[model samples]
Target: MDQISGVQQYHQLFGTKVYDADTAFEFLTIAVFQAGMSWKVAASKIPVFKQVFANFDYHKIAMFDEPDLEAIESNSNMIQNGRKIRSVLQNAKAAVQLEPEFNNLADYFWSFKPDKSEEGDRDTIGAVVAKDMKKRGFEFVGPTTMGLLLVGMGIIERRPNA
Candidate 1:
């Protein structure tokens, strides 16, 4: 298996090479899925999510049917909780509403920039921005999860030059 840094791995997996709006949108949706679970588990199952949810295309997910829900529920590769599975579809639909006015998910999401003047004091990148996500009105975006997404997607540069 090919090995890369965590940021590289997330880029390989979700195309969030930088802190762009699209990447933030995907990370936000993924964070909702990540509630009460480990990102490693979520990361491993992302491909299944992509296949089931039409590559995380908001328009496509908004139109999912019962068959899609059923397939996701039965998939061993996913979290399989009915609520989390359903959230994916619902979040996608929500994305539709947000997209027309906002440039991308990141644009809306990052509108809430935290007080980062003291960012240099933060030992880790994750520590820097999860606080901002909450202040920004993002629900379910805990520091750790936000940190993971930020670090993984290069939204926040990784510590120690990873």
Candidate 2:
């Protein structure tokens, strides 16, 4: 599929949904894996990720021990990046911690949504969220990744470059 259609499909699949913490963590994981790769390539690996990562269940993922990490590392179907793989585990733990502060991961993420009149580019907005997430111990969440996440979540629209 072309980029536009691929993005449209992604938005249809992810953007329009109401996220609970599990779903929110799932999409955040997607954004992490999508970094430095095309959406098509990243999207293709999602099914396997879901299977290996216990359907993006943060609580389950938080419990993933070294054996689980080894299984994921040994899985030929996975992305195979050690750091990114570890980050998923780390982020899961971080997401679990968010429950007490914000009620849920979804609420914490959604609280960053900017108003329509906000005057900043996607990177600018994403940086704000990224900074906060880093403070809370989330990994693999740089500005660009978070920008894509925001767009994917439909918290912010993807705008054409000026």
Best by the lDDT measure: 2
TM-score for each predicted model, relative to the true structure: 0.65, 0.87
Clashing pairs in 2: none
Clashes of each: 0, 0
Superposed by TM-score, candidate 2 places the C-alpha of residue 58 at a distance from the truth, in angstroms, of: 0.5
Superposed Cα RMSD, model 1: 4.9
User: Best TM-score goes to which candidate?
Assistant: 2
Q: Model 1 — TM-score against the truth?
A: 0.65
Which 10 consecutive positions of candidate 2 have the poorest summed lDDT?
A: 1-10
lDDT of 2: 0.81
True lDDT of residue 58, candidate 2: 90
Relative to the true structure, candidate 2 has a C-alpha RMSD (angstroms) of 3.6
Compared with the true structure, what per-residue lDDT tens digits does model 1 show for residues 5-107?
A: 4334554755245546444556766677778876565665555666677766767777988998898899887776887787667666665666667766666
Local lDDT at 126 for model 1 = 50
